[model samples]
Target: MGRPLIHRSPMPGLGLSMGITLTMLSLVVLLPIGALLLKGANYGLAGMWDTVNRPRVWAALYLSFRLSLFAALFN
Candidate 1:
C-alpha cells in the first residue's frame, strides 16, 4: 500500500505568514471604517427607535419581514 503524501511548511515561514495576515487585516479592514465607526459611535437609543418606528421605515421593515418569511419557506 502507498502512503499519502504530506507537505511540510518551514517553521520560520510562520512569522512571514503572520505578518501578511496582520497587514491584510489592518489595511483591508481598518482603513475604510471611519464612517461606520462614526455612525455607530453617534447613534443614540432614542434616535434609533425613532428612525425604526417611523412610518416609512416601519412599512419597509414589514415588507422585508413578509418577503423573507416566504423566501425562507420555499428556499
Candidate 2:
C-alpha cells in the first residue's frame, strides 16, 4: 500500500539529514581527534609510540568497552 500524497512532503529533497549528521560529527568528533594527533606529533615517533602503548591508555579503552557492554546487558 502507498502512503497518502497529501501527508507527504511536496518540496524537493535538500538532503538536510545528511548535512546535519556530517556537521555534528565534524564539530564534535573530528576536530578533537585532529587536535590530539597534532599535539601528539609534537613528540617524536618514539615518544608518540610510548604514549600510545602505555598501560593507562589500554586500561581506559578496556573500561570504556566494558562499561558500555555492561550497560547494554542491563537494558
Q: Best candidate per TM-score, number?
A: 2
lDDT of 2 by residue, 1-75 (tens): 997667656554557877889999999999999999999889978999998799999999999999999999998
Worst 10 residues of 2 by lDDT: 5-14
> Model 1: per-residue lDDT, tens digit, 1-75?
899988877675898899999999888888667655567467777776666688998899899999999999999
Overall local distance difference test of candidate 1:
0.81
Please list the residue runs of candidate 2 whose C-alpha ends up more than 4 Å from where it truly belongs after superposition. 1-14, 72-75
TM-score of 1: 0.44
Checking candidate 1 for backbone clashes, the offending pairs are none
* Residue 23 lDDT, candidate 1, scale 0-100: 91
State the weakest 10-residue window (summed lDDT) of model 1. Answer: 32-41
Stretches of candidate 1 above 4 Å error?
1-37
lDDT of each: 0.81, 0.90
